[model samples]
Target: MDVDTAPKPAGPLLALRGISKRFTGVRALDRVDLDVHAGELHVLFGENGAGKSTLINVVSGTFPPDEGTFQFGGEDISHLTPQRARAIGISPVFQEFSLVPSLTVEENLFLGREITRGGVLHAREMRKRAAALIDELGFDLDPSQRVDDLSRAHQQMAEIAKALLGRVRLLILDEPTASLTERETGRLFELIARLKSQNIGLIYVSHRMREIRALADRVTVLRDGRHIRTLDAATSTDSELVELMTGRKIDLLFPTITHKPDKVMVDVENLTSADGSVRDVNFHARAGEITGIAGLVGCGKSELIRAIYGIEPIASGTVRIDGRPYEFPAPRRSLKRGMAYFPANRIVEGLALSRPIRENASMTALDLPAFAGFGVLRQAAERIAIKGVMEQLQLRPPNIERPAGMLSGGNRQKVMLGRALTRELSVFLFDEPSVGIDVGAKLEVYEFMKRLVGTGAAVIVVSSELPEVLALSNRLYVMHHGRIAAELSGTEKTEQNVLAGFFREHLLAEVA
Candidate 1:
């Protein structure tokens, strides 16, 4: 093939042709073609099941392509193993991190590919090398610090640092900035620029269009396991990209709804965790409003909510639902009291992905008379009970027995919401519900939140996206270092104000 030759056509550093993959009855990719050039950031845009993950996995050697070939530096290396993939200078940073929580940054940096002598670990040299790498990347992190102790942003940095440990020529990042703040995202962009300067090829997979505009040299769209088309990023509009990705253009990202909060539903006073990660947290959610919580990644927003749901043990707190005291370390107790907590990662914590929708939805109502006793699921009764919420949330295909994993990002969330709706609730706690889903999915989740709160149920939303919080919440609280820093409402519900609140303590300390 002319592709495998010296002086490779000033073209792609890596080129994939006619790639196809199948799993069971599902054809994940079909004749997908992609090209990534050295010194270029190539963006792969696709909706769920569009073959983006399959293609990347093929390149990363997670699995072999059933058909087609991949050329690396002009050589057809289609049937390569993961070791060979790394040996040839390809490193991938996936959305779910691989860093071990128990290990230090230095230890994790050289984990499997460690420096060894006399069949013993070379800890000192590894630490030195890791320290140098962190410094080179301009990351503010201590090499000796445990991975569990680091903030999400710092953990992300550590993930990158681990990937760059080898002679990396092509770096693939999947949703790298999904959890990062604006400032953190800027820093990542700067680092990417530095890598690009070294003539390294970059495959950046992101749902955020702003990232593509800011970084992409070219954009490739995949649809239903086939290559749709590739366009120059500079010339492509977001609408055009959306059309290419979803096959339909959505003009509105969010639906407008007036927020009218009524009487208090869930009230917390002096909430503090044993670890002090969440300290003296005090807030309230009204019967008909979204109480938004916004802060940087490490702040106590997550822990504070977890404390209320009885997931995180509270050292001192008073939680009241409908003006009555509530207890901690008792999830069933909280659930029975009409309080539902939805986690950010729906796949792992929120729902059993492999299970049928019937089981997932009915899990919340196991204590209900129709679902209890005999230790066997009353399938017919369960379906009838969950049918209303499922229809209301508009789960695609409306298949009651579909596995939760088969649904798209948006539908998966709806499944969680459906389960929540089945239970009578006074307070609904959502933590970053709109993480990786598309615009349409986000609007659906937003609509669900509105509907739930409209039924005289209180909702507390903790999101990193300031616009989302502002749009969904009637009242907002910003946390910094385990405490509520500022509370905003009405005219004060601006992104700028929320950010100010996020850094209020730091600003005060700096001023002092």
Candidate 2:
């Protein structure tokens, strides 16, 4: 279904004039004007709280703009609802998934838009269409498989497929490849090219510089809830884009910290998860060193750390902390034994979104005397500590009483990190620490890691971003197929060496 021969539209496919949206205490978007042409792949570039998400929500009818006029196909479509937007060929694939875990791939794909004949459900037809669509998209997903059985990468693929199921003239993708593997990301790029050829306008939101260089024809920079500038992707340098998105000149994104390796704080020997996502992995995180674990998506890097922290079931393993064996580890026990884990998805696993910042920050050490006295909560003490931590993290708005859900992605992550400050911990595990935050926020996270290692703590960083890990880690481990493929340090930590470790040859050469 290529629409390469279709006639081009005269004006923009989607146009907004003075778009403004406001929440209880925040103006998410203010007086923003944007033009998205047919067949164009436009990228929304901004730091968190810069209003990129709000603009897309407005376009996709998640909410109406408080003020402004938007036109689609030369007709006014202000105050649009989600149903109307989808009916008129506007689809949005948000970062948060909307699929039911219990449902099959096809079931989740065509949940509300199921086909029927003579009041009978067209189950077979739906399966056929879903299979065809999956094949056409080159996604390695089975229509019969339950979504819960699929990996995060596959779940992301299913989300994208769901958005592309209908008559989509404008497709909105918010951090679509945040969970995708390299191969799957390539397929998505191919799909985007085909969609562009079909004259479907796409609005993409991503913080990854490589993705912007590869896919964005034009990039719209948003800053401080206003439209900053729209520049050609080819002409815009990374430094210029970073400066525009962050509203500040960042001389260095990653802070330099001297890695003075002390005694091994955490020692894992022949570790294997119950489900075998992590298999017989061996590594050590030394005090005063940022130990980095690098691998491809689904390579069990996160699973390894989870296993060490007792978040995942260990079939056979031993984790020795400070030369003492810790058997049958649990979260409470891990926290009690001076270990803190910051999960990859901050919204899902790290923070209670409905709770206030003070509550979330002090949740880690509530049993301690500083937070509670003889089973009674100390609100004053908790507030003072949380205020200090929030200030150190530079949380935007600095409102301790505000809900965690109201803050930006960066601030939410800060809340999770703030938990560590509430307690005295020696081992810190950060999984995809700065995944979806801004460059400015990422710098802060890097500095935070630097400061943690300076205190002689064992800071283990697990990241999919190669440069981030390489820059911060004193000792790095590359995982492949759920095992430690290579251990690299000093001259061995080069990109070529690390990438070689991603495949089987590095391990094979080690054996040879």
Candidate 3:
């Protein structure tokens, strides 16, 4: 049979059959099945803890299923190792940053398979290849630049370029545009379209409905470790896709904000950083209101927030809380003043992934009477306190003994929020709190934030997603070149207006 008339085999280019995995009574994948075809974009959609990640992990060789068979290219490869999976043309871009921070772009790109002559590595050839790759993509990044210094979007592009350097037949991208700007996402889509023309298969895993609608050719919905439905992307709406994954109609993804804005809670004047990432920034967060800071990557938003939270040294400026001068030389000092912060990278700065939920949740409130006993951490008391928090947050399994790492992305975020809540904080700072979570989970986090503000705590959210900012914030501030360029509140807080203001200044200058 010819390639076109081969009856389009009933299976898939890759297929999982009767896959099952269990960890301590939790069925991560319960006889689940999925299929992907050549020259098609397959999307996996599910809420957090619905076993989507487990299914991908099993297929990518991160782990093996207890009972199942994996057929790739009509061959049984059930027990292949991760290295073997990659060798056979399977590539995965994980949500976590996998680049070597200390290595240069050229070195990181060709780390495992450096160009060599006579058993010696050829540095010149590696640099030339990296330069060519950067030029081919029309990116202005320097090949010699250290990976650590590159912006998050540039780093992600480098990862994609590295994967393309190999003989990849199947590409699995997990939240590839979670932090990418609109322009960068457009460029990525161009690259993906180019790859699709060559008959390569793509498995795109993302929580953004917009991206799925634009890129996916076929969509698969998974719920609670079971394969729910597979549909043609052209025939499905975002609401329909979401309902399939969540098993319910979601009228509003963002919760209604009910808290009324009152007095100013956080006031900063002429805040400056030594590196010039943040220069003479001034802003105030109002009590019971969500003040969002929107900016492009490397625009110094994080640095400014760090200075406010006392993680970064302030070169010159004053921070005041309720008309009182607040100078915090460390994060502990900031916490002592009734302020809480959820850092951008949850795995690194937010939680002790290997620690149990009880320990991680109680870490921020160890000094409280409920969890402290005679200068010692009261284990029983801590568990009791965490139990209440877990219930309030709607965490699954409800087991305090599970390691934080074992939970899903959404659950881990909840753990971080739980930690912050334990502090009795009057001011809350959330930095990209919904980065890698599912759409349904993102809604839950937004609702939780609304409830937090109902207690009169002022909230500051720094996010790259413009829509999220428009939805959750009562007032929005766009940061450009380390300064607030535009502020929109009330009826003026539309996505178009915010984006127009952002581009009017930056885009005009670029064109001129």
Candidate 4:
């Protein structure tokens, strides 16, 4: 086969033909063809297992495709390595951080590509460059700070800053804004615009429709390891893109549930955590109702639930469950009292990723008679119960023995929700319930929340997505600087009202 050696004038900066990758028994990507031009913000739109990650990995040379012909500036470069990929200015910042936790931001940024004078490490020069990059990115972070000490958002900023340190021809950002605040996201968009102006190609992987609309010049939809469609992002409707990604139409993003509010199931008054992350919070979650706590990222919304669930120590507060005073709360005590809390950082706090699906799902309900009896493990009963719940959650593959780490973001989230189903619970506390998952998974989660409330169980959701919190909640509470700023219900739960609650202190100060 003769390959075209001549470069086409102003053609794609990077191109892949028949890119196919196989793992064990699975074909992760099949006969995929993609072209990314100079200065183009080409978005990779897909659901879980839709080949987005695999495609980017191939581009970054993390995974060599079994079958593919790659062209960079019209030259065939089939044999590509990670070093070669980086040498040619291809950089990827994945959802999972690649930074060393113990290392400072400056050290991590200059890790593999260290500056040296006569083979001696140029530490001062590296630090200066890192500081300049961080400042240019508008990141509120110290370059000397250890990666572990930085918050997830700050770590994300560090990742971006590192990527910008090199002569980047193509920058790949995988769910970059998943952990960022609105202001931070804006800063990132500005940086992206600057990159585009400099004629650097970018591949952005995101499930956010708003981001796709804002940054994407073109979007390529992938599904089940195959190329589905490549459409102009500016002209394509979200419905069209979603259908291509999922192979289905969604009638509603937020499913409606009948609210029949009863007595308060979980009540908190003047709650304050020992770490002072949450301060003087008050709220009530009634049975058969979805109480939403919404705010900007880093607001006390998540901390509020953490304090209530006994994950964080309560410095001062009162919690009443089912009209009974709950004191000295702990994990075991909270579980025994019929409360289930699904944390926002699912991988870290919720699911044990290395464990089997059955184990993770049954972890919360092991004390139940159906799972254990008289200190003896009932393996048969536990397996049956877990499988039943997995089926109800519509878990793909539905294999109880499969490692939780192997599942997609949506399925992994289902594993967490499955814990609540194995036992009877009066209250469900979900923190950032649907952050990284796709639309289809989000709907499934919403349905699960509805079913929980239908059974007269109270559901309290803490989320940064205003639309999700406002639409799902029967009553919405907005947090500002670790306190409840406003509570809206019925007609009062408009976006404007909720947004006002986000900056309540600033607004009040301006008015005064």
Candidate 5:
């Protein structure tokens, strides 16, 4: 496809000069400057808490910048409201889903701008247009389907279709492919290419290095809430980009697992879920080893782990912890049996976002000897304990008093992991522990997991990213349709082997 060569404007299509934002005296964005061309796929790279999101928020008019000048299409748009920004051709697809669950795809697509005849909404016309738009995007989705029933990937597609319906001069995609499969991601890239051909400017934010290389024309790096540097994507390597974003060399993102596999810490036999999501699942997580669970979405991997963690009810199964048969009817029951679970939705399930960092970190270990005094909580001792965990995890802005909600994605993850580390546990269940975290923090997490294994703790990690599972696990299990379809150990655990197993199960089912 030929590059779109539209008439060049006098100034940048969008420019942010000396942007600064503050939250309770914290300099979230400090004198940041950025520029996006008219038809360029400009990538924004930053570590967690480096102020990428804050900068985008300021640009998109989600938050009024304390100090900055935002120029767009030859006008100063520094203080425009979010609605006004959207009206003037700036749309954003945030990390979180923004669609209303109860609304149908047609309603979500043309939500506020439904076709009107005689001052009445034309539902029939809106549906027809939405169906055509869905077809144009090559997505197999019904226009009348409720948004709540669609998969996350499909919801994301709906968001892209909605953005395309507007006069979108600049489309900002924040971690757009974070939850998509390789095939779905390819379709998204194709759509992005088509958008670029129409001279639609794009500001792409992602942690995945491969996506940036494939989609970006130029790159901007931010660190510690400041603009660090800008470079042409064609001239940058993944390592170089990592160095720029992190300000240090990242030799190994995944630490070497040295702990030998020992006794089985958690054993699940014939576990099944009520929804039939998981059936006859069997696995044993060994002490001092990282056992990984990998599968495509809806493959029963999450259900299998949740059942063991007591988050989901089990139909017929026996869970043994250290050779003791146990009935884990609740999370507290599992916790009391020396089991810790770091849920995938950390913000929602793992931490108390409204509470202070120290409280969240020390919640599980409050009754410990060090944190307890005369049958009461000792505030001083709790602070000391939480501080140690923060230092070990390298949580940025390491303030124990800050609300967990105010921390960046990586730091929030650290707090979640800190909760597990506070209590002495024999088994740890991690569900997508590094989902929204940055590269540097991911390395820190990898090292922390290795350290936990070194201390004779068993670890079970459930992840959708194949590289993360292959890089960290001592044993790998691939699940398909509620059962463990294949297990790879020692020299057999490779990406090719896992993919082959995944596809082979599909082929067998097709034949059957």
Candidate 6:
């Protein structure tokens, strides 16, 4: 699976000239030329469907380019086979990992190509080699530890180690730090620097400017399957990159909210998750207000909201809807108290991807008498209702019959939000609603949230992006270690305090 090839000179390690790829009637990539030198980090920037994935796939030998000249160390590698690409020292680590979770770190490192003697299994030899590689990469990982037990950061590192199992000269990382927390991203960046020191050429594909600014040496912009321009990382600005990718200047990413909050709609006291992930937390959300929850990953912000929505079992908690005590896991009991939750992942937790847009948007109304007559859905009524919501959200080519999965990132989110707004709900829970959506769509969503709160409905939003939360929310609750660490309102709400709240328990522990 791997070849021990000598390292070439520190010149143009990989060159792609006039690369073009097509899928059906769409041109995914068009005559894009990229040159990556040894010990350099080349970043690919684009919008969600901007051909970055296609280019990376071609380079990794998922398929050969239709028209292009690809050179590796000055040697022609055009139309290279996948196995040949790997053997010749090109390894790709995609956003979705290829590691088997049940296997150990060392076992996954040399998964397909194992160390064996006389056709017998050699665990010791494989473990030793894996440990050596882990040490060389300066990673703190036990080779024998199962990948299921590893954190997301460690799992990512394991995938990288697997890519470097052979003579790895060129490393391609596709959104390597997308799922990582702030600290995990920092660790991954440090590892990338170490690889750079070893003269490995890295091609990074990401839409996030923070990652690009931190890692990119030179950035190549792609728009509508065409190479716009390649700019020096040091000279490029976020606005410039946005302008190039979208062909428009977005002066504001988040819209300002002037609406005021009214009466308390949701009130919780001593809430705890059944799994003990979320500790005792007292929270409140008033009608006509957007209350934002801020925390790092695994800080129990999501669990707290889930418990409130009856999606998670509450161990010990008292929740009140309109000041009336509501029991956990409602609807089984005769309580009409409920909340609409928009999960972070629209495809997985939010939308039924294969279902029609009308059905997905009108799913909540299945029990309502307006759309559901005698439990059978009235197709005409559902279509008419959702089409109106789609127009309000400004969904492109608004056709309710289309599948939810076929839409772009922004449109898909709009479809999901439409489902929530179509129903009658007292509180709305949005977890990272603006993630992976375009600037125009993000603003549209924000405006919709303002209008929703304007209708006397309480909105509670959970987001990792601090600026959006600060800009849109009427109040901020920062969670730390399964509990509410700080409640910030008015001038007390700052990014520093909200982010610092993530480390509040750790800081307390350190001082003690």
Over 275-382, each residue of candidate 5 has an lDDT whose tens digit, in order, gives 889998889999999999999877888788888888888889898989889885578877788888888777657888889999999988876788897899988878
Score each candidate by Cα lDDT.
0.83, 0.91, 0.83, 0.88, 0.85, 0.81
Q: What are the per-model numbers of colliding residue pairs?
A: 0, 0, 0, 0, 0, 0
The best candidate in terms of TM-score: 2
Sorted on TM-score, highest at the top, how do the candidates line up?
A: 2, 4, 3, 5, 1, 6
Best by lDDT: 2
The weakest ten consecutive residues by lDDT in model 3 span 1-10
What are the runs in model 1 whose C-alpha is more than 4 Å off? Answer: 1-9, 118-120, 145-152, 353-358, 379-408, 502-505
Off by over 4 Å in 2: 1-6, 504-512
Deviation from native of the Cα of residue 239 in model 3, angstroms: 1.3
TM-score of each: 0.89, 0.97, 0.93, 0.95, 0.92, 0.87
Query: What lDDT does candidate 4 reach at residue 404?
Result: 91
**Model 5 worst lDDT run, 10 consecutive residues:** 1-10
**Runs of candidate 5 exceeding 4 Å displacement:** 1-11, 365-381
Shift in Å, residue 495, candidate 4: 1.1
Q: In model 6, which range of ten residues has the least summed lDDT?
A: 329-338
Question: Model 1: per-residue lDDT, tens digit, 76-187?
Answer: 8956888889888899897768899999999998877899999998888898889888888878889999999987778888998888887887899988987677777888
lDDT of 4 by residue, 32-108 (tens): 99999888999998888788889998999899999989987668886778788887778899887889999999999
Two-way lDDT contest, 2 vs 4, winner: 2
lDDT of 1 at 195: 79
- In candidate 1, the residue pairs with backbone N, CA or C atoms under 3 Å apart (3 or more residues apart, or in different chains) clash, namely none
Q: lDDT per residue, candidate 6, 18-101, as tens digits? A: 999986556778999988988899998776557777888888998789998999878888667767888788999976578899
lDDT of 1: 0.83
